[model samples]
Target: MSNEFALNAEARSDLGKGASRRLRRNANLVPAVIYGGDKAPQSISLLAKDLAKLLENEAAFSHVLSLNVAGANETVLIKALQRHPAKGYVLHADFQRVVAGQKLQAHVPLHFMNQETAAGVKTGGGEISHTLSEVEVSCLPKDLPEFIEVDMAKVEVGQIVHLSDLKLPKGVELVALAHGSDLAVANIHMPRVQAESEDTGTAAE
Candidate 1:
């Protein structure tokens, strides 16, 4: 994946809730902060519409961001985001500085491939249950993956794919498996209704 996420941000001098509210209402900007990596926390604001547009791409979350703050480009990653409770508009965002060769933890989305043709679903008439839609991984910035692929082609009914079952990209490591946890990532099982119907059929026979 190309590292091309760039946003234009303006440094903000104002502080407190009132200032943030004014920036949102009057300036139509989303308040944000940048911290970490030997730099003091800096308050900044970005165009609400622009930020929303940038977020439309799913890769923006895991890929490193190039934030142009007052003409200086800063390499950072999205740490957190706060949205309006009712309207779901972005209220604030947090960014953390990232340095080359330094390892960091990030949650990458999981992509289940070949689920429709999996042996469990095609032959066993089972449903695929995804226990985890995302996974946390530790890797350097260059080794970070936008998403992890979980192949389900050979999965059978009653079989579960755990954290250790996932094939990590080179240089990336699963945080859970590293700590000795083999949590389930996905599984195939018969639906409750189907199980009950089969039980009734067996009794009738």
Candidate 2:
């Protein structure tokens, strides 16, 4: 899947709780900063409402972003986001600048499709299970993907779809694999109650 979205940001000179509150109230802008790639951190502000709208899509959190900060533009990935706890509005965001030449670690969402129509789910008394929602992957900025598609059509009861089994984008690699944790992205399993009843009934016989 492909998406092209842009974030418009402005340079911000003032910082601190009071200054941020004033900026939010007066200008309706949210404070943010950009860092990474040997460049010093730059303080900036993004259009609050626009930023909120962009974030509504799950891809926005994973895909590389084109940020227009004042007159300078940068390709970056979202490193972290902070929000107003009570109001649930975005207060600040942290951007990790991406360099075209270097491989960067980006979080990629996992999209599982066609599981409901799977043969296993239809006749094997199986249910779809999600093990991993997102994964950290490394790739070049130009090779970035919004998400990785995991097909559950082949998944069967008692079977697991692991990280090693995922088909990654070209030049992309998963970081979670090195952690030695075999990440089960998804699985189709028989209903717990049904399995238990079968086991108990078989044991009694």
Candidate 3:
């Protein structure tokens, strides 16, 4: 919510792969579409440099964005981005319109905190393994979180952090948890070498 992004775009009448290629090659424009809410999809084009600059910030992926299309303002969230396989430039972009008072689903990144100071690593000689890097959350656009934090300070070896164990922000809900899937987020466990050594000792006994 603290991070704000805005882009200026022009509505594009030309469509198809050929037109898109020309836009990118000649005009340095990136074709995009905005959909969702009660309105039909709108085809648009944005300056490639502008789009790239906006995407440079990681929070832009999760925070609600203000898009000015042909002088009309639309509140939206980045839904997807098509990138050139090797060069890694934006080929196409998709935006989902944000409807006020309606619940929306988006994937937010997870930030692991206190990994070095965790009880498992500091005293138990364990390593932290992350099973999920991001999680889908359901919340109103205004309540969307830039990222969720996973606290590992108190975690001990053999402790697994599950989706249900995450402390979500106010008014935010995990999509998987709502569907009854409490997926593992991260875990603190013995180092791989130590674990394997113990297993070998047990087998030899």
Top candidate (lDDT) = 3
lDDT of 1 by residue, 71-171 (tens): 89898889899999999899999999998889988888899999999999999999999999998899999998999999999999999999888888999
Which portions of model 1 miss their true places by more than 4 Å?
1-4, 200-205
TM-score of 2: 0.89
lDDT of 3 by residue, 42-101 (tens): 999999999988888888988899999878999999999999999999999999999999
Off by over 4 Å in 2: 1-4, 196-205
Query: Which lDDT tens digits does candidate 2 get at residues 1-205?
Result: 1335788889888988898888889999988899998899988988898899989989888877889877677888899999888989898899999887898988888888888877679778799889889999878878888889998877778888899998887988888886776687888888899999999999999
Error of 1 at 57 (Å): 1.1
Error of 2 at 182 (Å): 2.3
Instruction: Tell me the deviation in Å of residue 77 in model 1.
Output: 0.7
Residue pairs that clash (backbone atoms under 3 angstroms), model 2: none
Clashes of each: 0, 0, 0
